[model samples]
Each structure stands twice: as structure tokens, then as C-alpha cells.
Target: MATALPAPAALLLWECAARAFGLLYFPPPTSIAARAYHLWFSGPPAHLFLTAEAVEDLLPSLTRLVVGWTLAAALGLATGLALGRLPILAALADPLLHIGRAIPPPALLPLFLATLPIGTPTQLATILAGVIWPILINTADGVRHVHHAYLDTASVFQLGRARRLLYVIVPAAAPKILAGLRLSVSLALIMMVVSELTASTDGLGYRLQNAAGSVDVPAMWAVIVLLGIAGIAANGVFLFVQRRLLRSGQAARPRGHVLAWQQ
Candidate 1:
């Protein structure tokens, strides 16, 4: 209850300021909210109240965001684990990894556009390029820094390589990996919007660009607000899942090896 006050309070303040100043560019929140509802949520109940515009734009954007993020997460985790487990490989790849991550993702949009198809492929590539670094870097760092005691314990238990990784390395590194994932979620959302801003037919970003091009301030604000809501919702869901996973992992710990996990 306390935490929710800030947003509503800010919106109320914004509403008063916009109304008082009669700002053409910054319309009141009421108008923006109305525009958003009519634009996206004015459909019939059978269609889940999604307007055609929403169906055409919102769904595609969500699909791309999910698919791109999933692919990046999978690749990042796998490569990070391999590199973390192999010091020589990590050493060999460190320079290249740094260079790759250093380049801004948006800067590569042109290259992606030239090389890939202009629609979903380009968007996915952009998202993957942008969001993979955090996950990879954090996962590697977490896995590499996992206390040697954990490894020793695994070895003493005669655990197989896969078992050791599943039970020890991954569980130990879960927190850092989850942190990376959380960070990447925001990056993925940003990239999703950015990737749609050009060379695409439909998406929230495309709609935003269209609205901006038409000088539709209310529509633009609506898109911006929707994006903010999406970001907040995504973060909330990620945090909930993270907590649940951590709790389950802790609960699943073997009694005999509890001290090792605690350490």
C-alpha cells in the first residue's frame, strides 16, 4: 500500500500540472489513459478487449521479446558455464568477449538490417546482441568464483560431471545468474522497442514511431506509459520467480551437504 502511493501521487501531480499549464506537448494523464484504452483495449470481450491495433502490434512485439530473450539466455548460460569451467578457454575468449560487449547494440542495427531480414530476424538479432552480455559475464563470474570447497565436496561425493554441475555449480551460481537475467530483462525490453522503431511493420515501437511522426502527443505518451507498465510488470514477475526458485533450491538441499551449500 505504501509503495504504490508514489506512482499515483506522481500521476496526480502530472495531471494537475499538465491541466494547469495546458501543455500541448505534455497532455494530462487522463487523456493519455483514455487514448491508450481506446487504442488497445476497446475491443469486444470475446477478443479479450484487445483492439485490432493491439493484436497487430502488441502480440508481435511480445513474441519477439520472449523468443529473443530466451535464445540469448540459453546461449549465454551455456557458453558462460563452459568458459567458467575452463580457465584456458576463458583466458582465450576474454579479449573477444570484452570487445563484443563494448560495442553498442543499436550501433549494429544497420549491420543487422543489411545482413538479416528486416522484420523479426533483425529484431531478434538486435535483442540478442544487446542483452546477452550481462548474463554471460555474470554467470561466468559467479561460476568461477564458486568456492573451491563446493567443488571439493562434490568430488568427495564422487558426483559425476553433470550431476556436480546440476547440483553444485548451478545452484551456487544461481543468484548471480538470476541477477544477470533480471538486468537483461530491461535490456531486452529496450532492444525490443528499439529494434521495432525502424525497418518493421508492426510493434509497439513502430506504433510509437508512427504516433511521433504524426505529432500525436497523446498517443506517444500512451505508448511510453504502456512500455513503463510492461517494464514494471516484467521486473515484478522475474522477482517473484527468482524468489520461488531460490526457496525451492534451498529446500531441496541434502541434509548431509547442507553445510557445504551454506558456505
Candidate 2:
């Protein structure tokens, strides 16, 4: 309760300032909230109070974000695991990985646009290009640093390769992989908006662009607020899943094994 006061207090101050100054561009919070609700949330009860614009624009952006992020996460985890397990492969790919990560995803958007269709495919590629590096690097680092004792235990049990990877290696490295995933969520959202900002007909970014062009400051603020809410919601969901997975992983391990791994 105490921690939550600051945000509302700050918003109240902002509202007072905007109203006092009669700022056209920076509208009060109340007005912005009203605009946002009308634009995206006001609708028939059958559609869960989602306006047609929200259904058309917001849902597609969210779909792209989820699909693109999932693809990046899968690809990153697989490649990272292989690299972590094989020093030779890691060595060979090290320079390439460094170079690839250094290049910004948006810089390659032109190439993607030229090659792929100006829709989901190109958007996904942009997201994958940007979001994969952190997950890959973090997973590889985590796996590499896993306690050798764990591996020795698996070997003593004569665990097959698949079983060893699934049971021992993945759980051990999950913390790092999850950290990478957390970072990638934000990157995925940014890429989603950027991918839709140009050569696109629909999505939140397109709506934002149109609002700005038309000088609809309140609408722009509404979109910005919606994006903020989306980000917070995404992070909240990830944290919930992270906690559940970590707890389950700990439960599955032998007593004191997690402490030993931490040490």
C-alpha cells in the first residue's frame, strides 16, 4: 500500500499541473484515461468491452509479439544449449555471435522488408533478430557454469543424453535462461511496435503514427498509456511463471542440491 502511493501521487500532481497550465499537448490524466477507455475498452458486453478498433489493431500486435518472442526463445535456447555443451562450437561461433548481436535489429529491417512480405513474417524476423542474442548468451553462460558435480551425478546414474539434458542441465541453467527471457520480452515489445511503424496498415504503432500525424495528442497519449500497461502486464505474467518454474525445479532436486549449485 505504501509503495503504490507514489505512482498515484505523481499522477495527481501531473493532472494538477496540466490543468493549471491549460496544456494542450499534455492533457490531464483523467482525460487521457477517458480517451484510452473510449478508444480501446468501450464496446458491447459480448466482446468483453473491447472496441472494434482494439480488436483489429491491438490483437494483431499482441499476436505478433507473442509469436515472435516464442520463436526467438525456442531458437535461442536450442542454439545456446548446443553451444554451451560443445566448446568447439562455441569457439567457432563466438565471433559471429558477437558481430550479429552488435548489429541493431532495425538496421536490418530494410533488408527484411525487401525480402519478406510486409507483414507478420518481416515483423517476426525483426523481433527474432533483436531478442535472441540475450537469451542465447545467458543460456550458454549459465549452462557452462553449472556445477560439475551435477553432471558427474548424472553420469554416475548412466543417464542418457536426452534425459541428462532435460533433467539435469536444463533445470540447472533455467535461472539464466529465464533472465534472458525476461529481457527479451521488453525487446520483443519494442520490436513489435517498430516493425509496425512503417509500411503497415494496422497495429498500435500504426495507430500511434496516425494519431501523431493528425496531432491527436490525447489519442497518442492513450496509445502510449496502453503500451505501458501492456509492458507491465507482460512483466507481471513472466515473473509469475518464473517463480512457479523455479519453485518446481527446486522441489524436484535433492535436498541441499540447490544450495550447493548456488555456492
lDDT (CA) for every model shown?
0.92, 0.91
lDDT of 2 by residue, 68-145 (tens): 999999999999999999999999999999899999899999999999998888888998999999999999998888
Per-residue error for 151 in candidate 2, Å, reads 0.6
> Per-residue lDDT tens digits of candidate 1, residues 97-163?
9899999999999999999988888999999999999999999999998878778988999999999
RMSD per candidate (Å) reads: 1.7, 1.5
TM-score of 2: 0.95
> Best-fitting candidate, measured by TM-score?
2
Off by over 4 Å in 1: 1-3, 254-263
Q: Score residue 124 of candidate 2 by CA lDDT.
A: 89
Pairs in clash, predicted candidate 1:
none
